[model samples]
Target: PTLRTSLPSSSPSLSPTSIPSSSPIYISRSNPTIRKPTLAPVQILYDVTSPKDDIKIYFGKDDNDGREGPPKPHEVATNVLDNSGKKYLNYNDLGSGFTVEVLDKCVIKGARFYPANDREGRDPSSYKIEGGRRRKNGRWRWSTIKSGTIRLPAARIKVTEPKLDPRFPHAEILFENQREFQMYRVTFPTLKDSDSEHSMQIAEVELLGYFTGGGVSLEGVRTTPISSSSLIAESSNPVSQKKRFKSTGTDRAENLQHSFEEKGPNYLLDLTTQYDMVGILKMNGVFKPDHPRYKKLTDKTGAGFISRVKNDALVIKPAIGKTVIRGARFYTSDSEEKYDPSSFVIDGGVEEANGEITWRRIRAGVLNMPSARVDRKTQNIDPELHPHDGVWFNNDEVYDMYRMTFPETKDNSVNYEMRISEIELVGYRSTRKLEESNFNIYDLITTIYFWRYEGSLTVPPCSENVQWRIFDRPIRISPRQQATLEWLIRAYRDPDTCQRATVGRPRRDGTGNVDVVRPTQAIKYDHLQVHCTSANY
Candidate 1:
């Protein structure tokens, strides 16, 4: 858990004028563009520290009925069992630190620190402050805000302002050019004396910032046990029986469709591939040289055919390490008649060796899929469940793709396709901690029964550098809610005239064929591996 401390009650609500003019700072809601913060003393997050057992109380706001009055004394503590009933603010050695993150978007004007009394060499002398903002891809990037050393006060002055000169240690520093930010991380790089190995102690840290009214509100952020939702569901019996196949069969596909449950250890994939020249392999059908629909299927825009149905795409934080995603398979919802066809692409990446992870979209994360004809002859006679209109991509790229289940009608009538506006992307941090996610560990892990086979991208360029892993375990989705994603895959339109790119063309979902599952293709020489919680199944 990230270490955080709140302000104490009984501390007076300060106005900008309280500080000396040398520090010139302002804290007011007079600017309509920047609203006043709804919450106060802001949260403090700690890092790189062990304790020497010392207690310090902060005086600020009270938690009583969530009301803000005067600054009162409050102890900083985590309710964890080891530190239960004890409120000690201690940093074992040097280079220990903490951060203050505003609950909302705000402009930080200035800050002040109050050192703990009686701590001589343990008091922090030099510190570094950084500002951070969230990127479009939902990752944070920090920039240096200020850094300086302060002189320890001798008398018991309630509040003392230290002279901060970037160059005096030597130059002058100020926040005259305040920018909107959501976080300010403060690191105590050095104590009063470099020769001393004593831990640092801080009684209180305060920040002055006005809300920008634009960032995510940390007030509603919470951590609770993951329940049955889009990510995972409770099962009386997770998996019944498991079987393998030297060659694909009806029973194997059936078992893969509904028998297995999402659970167990997660295996990391090597997802460092380049995006271009890469495509997902279509297990059921690869684009054939002589097919009549060849010209349209090979068009630069893969959105031509499936553009009629609203399609949705989601992006999830990949598991730690190199996440090698060769191929993805879908499962039928408990209340659905068929599995919705979708696509996924690697968009961004992060290296976990460093404690911090920053996500960025991979260049070649796009996929191309040629429409596979649903068998019109056997539409109702023999309903084909898993149509082979497989999602194909070239293996030269690395990215994370999240394909959501389309909504189904309550009466099970029409299934909607993808839509541009309806496409959803949920960012995640590769761990089981749900503080920033809607999924749990169980939702990301699955017992996969897979067989590798050499295949070609089912679209144009017909590149054959594809290694496919056809999973037998099905990923479940709620049928009734899946169709809501139909608008995202709507037909392509002319950017200039706003007309359909291909006039009179049938939408991917409009084809009368219900079975899109490609006919069982023969598997070539390749290894078969089943990854699960237990080998017994």
Candidate 2:
């Protein structure tokens, strides 16, 4: 079924024709190319969920470099088969037998498989564990790395390879020799002489490898390798302690600089650092408050601030040229969860030679802030509660200079204020190299887990071009910092009006009320892909 988003009559209309022709589009989410260096043994585990009695697990390079399409059977490198000849426990049951381990010398030293069932007519003798290396010309050279017959209930096959050269004290040295690839394929093979049909099902596929401190570029080229000795030294200590920075009404420069030096420029700290807060606009009005349609901004139910990135814009240029952003990671501010933004829109485009900024709609989605279970007795995030951290947006088109508008929120009764600590953007980069352009967001977080999907911007000119990568973890802020966020929001003034901006609807009572959350919308599409760091960060 085709997926569609239903917007309110007052909301902007979305047309499929609005999608830009030159947009960057990724055929599929590829596994993380970078691998952290490790000295310990590495293991890749497959939790099969298939009901089929026979299955084969293939590991190595795919035909299209494991990017464009599914893996083909002929492109197998290292493979293991589960042919017990009889149904065992559930596919994901532990000890049902499917595991692989690589020793420090970068060799496939061991593998375990479920033993074949011994029945009157069953043949439980034939099984093979094969390993191969890929040639530079994109061809796989096959050889049986290890081979043995199955045991009674379970079989553990171990192989001993030649010792490594002591001169080069790194596991990557072995990888360089074999030219190993990083791709996995699981298929249900047909029975030898049976007419039974088989289906493919999988519950989980896990690859456990040591942190090599080395990384692979987007093009599958290996970067400079780090030694095991250095990796050991680095892993013993934490990278850096999280520092708390506050933004008071008067102390902006010092705090800003400290944050940049500590967290780097790409880490989302506050709106003031990255964007220029243009002004506040009423939700119902399309034009700015200064426009003739809405001559002056009024206290309304859906009023939000508009902000644009700084002069030196942050651009997202994927190697493919265009991409669809589906979602994002929104960190909560110090204020109560009620003040968090419930809905927003992200726009991206290039800046013209003139001072003007050209805009194209990128993504629209609701911000689902996790509940802050603040104990009345002691004001701190309750560790016991789930989702007390960050919310994921797995939903885009590509844009460099992103313009985000927070129009609606979770609660409308209170004055709306967005208090986000950080907004991490995760995805692939083009060959032009973002580092050359001073892109610091990459490698900000050691291990990143995210969900990717297709969605539209939540606001006007709702373009469906965004590729959302919402971080699974949330950034924690202190109570003092939360209070600081509230202070900053109220302190902000409209540059055009030279008047205080209205954050929420005005009530008759004298008491203060703040709410800027947009209600959750129905999900139109269901396709979601998950990506995580390959190494155990």
The candidate scoring highest on lDDT is 1
Residues 1-537, model 1: lDDT tens digits: 112232324233222111111111111222212122222223222221112211122222222323332222332421101112221233333444554453434445455554444545656677676777778999879888777776655432122323211111111123532355556566667677535433555544444444332313111321111111112112111112212212244454333322221242132111211111122212222312322222221111122222223322232332222232322312222222322323232233332444322333221111111233233222111102322211111122233332222222122235554321111111221323345656676644344455556676654454657777765565444221232223222344688998754323233543211222343546545533334334545
Q: What C-alpha lDDT does candidate 1 achieve relative to the native structure?
A: 0.32
How well is each residue in 338-404 modelled by candidate 2, as lDDT tens digits? Answer: 6665655555545445534345545443455666422222322111221222211211233434445
In model 1, how many backbone clashes occur?
75
Over 4 Å off, model 1: 1-92, 134-140, 156-174, 215-537
Error of 1 at 446 (Å): 67
Off by over 4 Å in 2: 1-328, 373-400, 412-537
Q: What is the lDDT of residue 414 in candidate 1?
A: 58
